[model samples]
Target: MQCTDHTVSLDTWKNIQSLGIQCKRTTYRGVRAGWRKQVKKHTNASPPGNVSLNPPSPSVNLGVINAQSVGSKSAILVDSILDHKFDLVAITETWLKPDDSTADFTPDGYTFTHIPRVSKRGGGHVTEPTHYLGRMLDLVISREGESILAHTKVKERFSDHFVLACKLNMNRPPTLKKIITTRHLKAINITDFCSDFCSSAFSTNLSEITDMSHLVDQYNKSLTDIFNMHAPAKTRTVIIRPFSPWYNDEIREAKHKRRQLEKKWRRSKLEIDRQLYSEQRHFVIGLMCNAKINFYSALINESANDQKQMFKTFDKLLHRSKDSPLPKSSSDEALANRFSDYFIKKIKTIRDLFPPTVTSTCIDVSTNICLDHFTLTTEDEVRKIIMNSPSKSCSLDPVPTWIVKEGIDIFLPALTHLINTSLQSGSVPAVLKEAHVRPLLKKSGLDQDDLKNYRPVSNLPWISKLIERVVSARISDFQERNQLQECYQSAYKKRHSVETALLRVQSDILSALNSGDICALIF
Candidate 1:
């Protein structure tokens, strides 16, 4: 990848500080244009210990720097590498010239990877395996759908170093399970699909079936087929670029020219070439700084009028990472067994929280069965629940909330009957019982290795949540109608909070103290 601009100064630091962003110690503003902070590994080791001894970071923040002969900016680059804590940095044109030793450029946590380009320019051809004017397809042993991409740039902007980029999926190995994609959900012909599904599946007996589970299965499969046919999922590369409105083609050309001149100066032993390179370098630096000042000034003006836009601008500067590598046991068999054990233990804990069977409940200070005045869960209630729910993706389910809500008109009777049947039979389907556990990092700046740092998020299907919502509504209605709630109870009740509870306690304490009942208050 070609770099953006190799420009940094006190003004750049002030710009970042004004935005409340902390500057990394050895700023690699030139390492890669607009350097993003590296994701440091979680380690208990204090200062003075070798960083390389620490466990490897989940990712490598690579920066390619061209020192134009290492002596000039060697210290600055070393400090930047240490401060940003880059895992792997590829440096080029160090002007090592095959005679120089590699003592000075090495930093604490890092070791250099590539061989510097040697100049035998006076003698015809270069001996580099891969050069700008060369091509070789570096293929990896990958699965059928997997891809390996190699991109080249005509100009080396950041430094004259050759960019080595390889981005893997980082997802777990592929399974035999049929994957479904819904990339084009909005374009699906829902009305037509529903019309066909109803005709083919339910035309025989219509709504006469007592058991609706079979119908629900047919409904699910039909919808799945429609999705598979219309918007099937495929393996595709997703590149997310930062929002940089000010970076234009003019600056791109200037950076490219400056890099060419730097390379030319490095290769030549002549004084005139060196002078030309120095002059061009200074001109590019001034152009870059001016461009940045104008961009930020415009950004600040626009941001003053819009808070959301300003927050977005702030988020872009931070470039927060959320990649957490999956933890695995030794073997495939071991992993499978561990997962089985975990889910088994988790289910046991969950089951322990509830009674063995569902039973009717009564209001009014009593906790006994009340079959006489039990209300039947209605079809309208289910429809209303689906309608009001927000559209979002669940963990494992292929079906989304919007799809469920959109198809409610066609699937209402089936869903309503299914829910009622589940309630009446004192059981829910096995699908609802199953859940996916995702471990999310508690903070962006925490050790990812320790299990304690992650919070397990239980993701059951949205339909399961909808069922729970319905049940919760009934329980709430019963409590509200019977007036069984306490006045001072500020929990599990709407418009009540810990703040209100604290205020009540504070008032009682103050009343006692004001009335000269300090002893009573203390007691």
Candidate 2:
């Protein structure tokens, strides 16, 4: 035997050798007309007397056939293989070319390696009738005589070609199988939780604690205790399967119906049953396609205003996996310490760039622009701020933002006093300053295990954010009155954004063109 055009892979060669076949590389002469006769002579020859046809041991069943063309006959081929319980299969005369993929013809739980006759259109030998026709054009050969048992011709015809099933006295080698913790927030009753919070000492005795640190600590502890009582955390081992964003209940039911119909068709083998199964299969396919379309359309519509969310939606659609896990060499504590050291060193390096002290003398200005102290917050102002803020919370928060908003009226007085106390003392409580810092990947397509590829995202306590908002509002008001803010700065200003900045640039360019002045922009 000679192989010319395509080379068999080392793994495939090893598999062939394991079956007791000896292969050697040889130059291929052009196909001769007598090559078929020569192959037939060799295939029909008897094995040596020393070789045993059947060994008293467990063995593997293998099948071979001439597919002629496997493209449209893959389904039939798969069914025949399953019915025969063939451990492996070798196909011939597949009529495949270099450009064709074997994956399209390969069955599930099986893989294929093809060495197409690339040099010519068709050139193979013939055998005894294993086909509907009187002659068999397909051949199955084994190097070791004992490896090829008597070929039993299958009664079923696969695309006008018959299968040669054989049992080999060779043993097949044996092949070698995230817990998440989440709180049951859905089980919590908002009404009962609010009533319980209102009755708690943290609410009623807020005025008794004058110390800011003690007040903050008690606030955290009380809210956590109440929240945990209502919705406790649970841990379970969950199977991580491929995420199908569009797979919902409706599609699941359709798929279940399709499977039932398929089973019925296979069992009954009736025309009506087959037709019903086919129709159901098509229906399920259509349902899945429509569901996927609707899912993406809705996602696009909802994320129209949010570019970050829009990008995330694109990632979902593209089926991009999350960042790789952190390196396993370091323990959790060690990783945290390393991150802290890196950030600290980075801060110190930046600080080192500046002088230790400034020698410039202070100059007094005559303008009456001053923001020495922040005014104490009123209950109304505090309520407005809480209501207007986005309902987002950090894990560090004693309660979720939605829960706080839900019980705002009950929480108003104490929250109002806390804000006023902070403003009066011109200091934030230590507990409120604490944040849950999570290291997030800076962007996609980066080495996630590297510390440099991540940035720390700090989620501060809700009350701390509220106080910061109050201070920001006061500073903004002072800036507006004194015109201390830069005129060209569009970010972090009300009703101002990247769009506004772009519009300003466009207007300036247009004005420059109208005035016959050349405008050069620099990044």
- Alpha-carbon RMSD of each model: 16.7, 14.6
lDDT of 1 at 46: 21
Residue pairs that clash (backbone atoms under 3 angstroms), model 2: none
**lDDT (tens digit, per residue) of candidate 1 on 1-523:** 3333333554564466579853333333333321111111111112222223222324344444444456554434454454344444545455565555454456532344445444541111121112322242121222333322111112222233323322222332222243343376677677875675566555435456555466445545665676666667665554332123455677668767867875654343234444556567657656655665687677777898778778776654343234554445576576445555665677799899998888878555555644333255787888888887767667555456676677778767766766666566655667776777666767766765445565666788776787688777777677787776687799988789999988988899898888988534342
Pairs with steric clashes in candidate 1: 3-158, 26-80
Using lDDT, give the best candidate's number.
Answer: 2
Q: What do the candidate models score in CA lDDT, each in turn?
A: 0.53, 0.69
Candidate that scores best on TM-score: 2
- What TM-score against the true fold does each predicted structure earn? 0.49, 0.65
Local distance difference test, candidate 2: 0.69
Model 2 lDDT tens row, 258-364: 66865554344344444566677667656756776798999999999989889998876654545545644457899888878887788899999999898888676
Off by over 4 Å in 2: 1-177, 301-311, 321-325, 359-364, 446-450
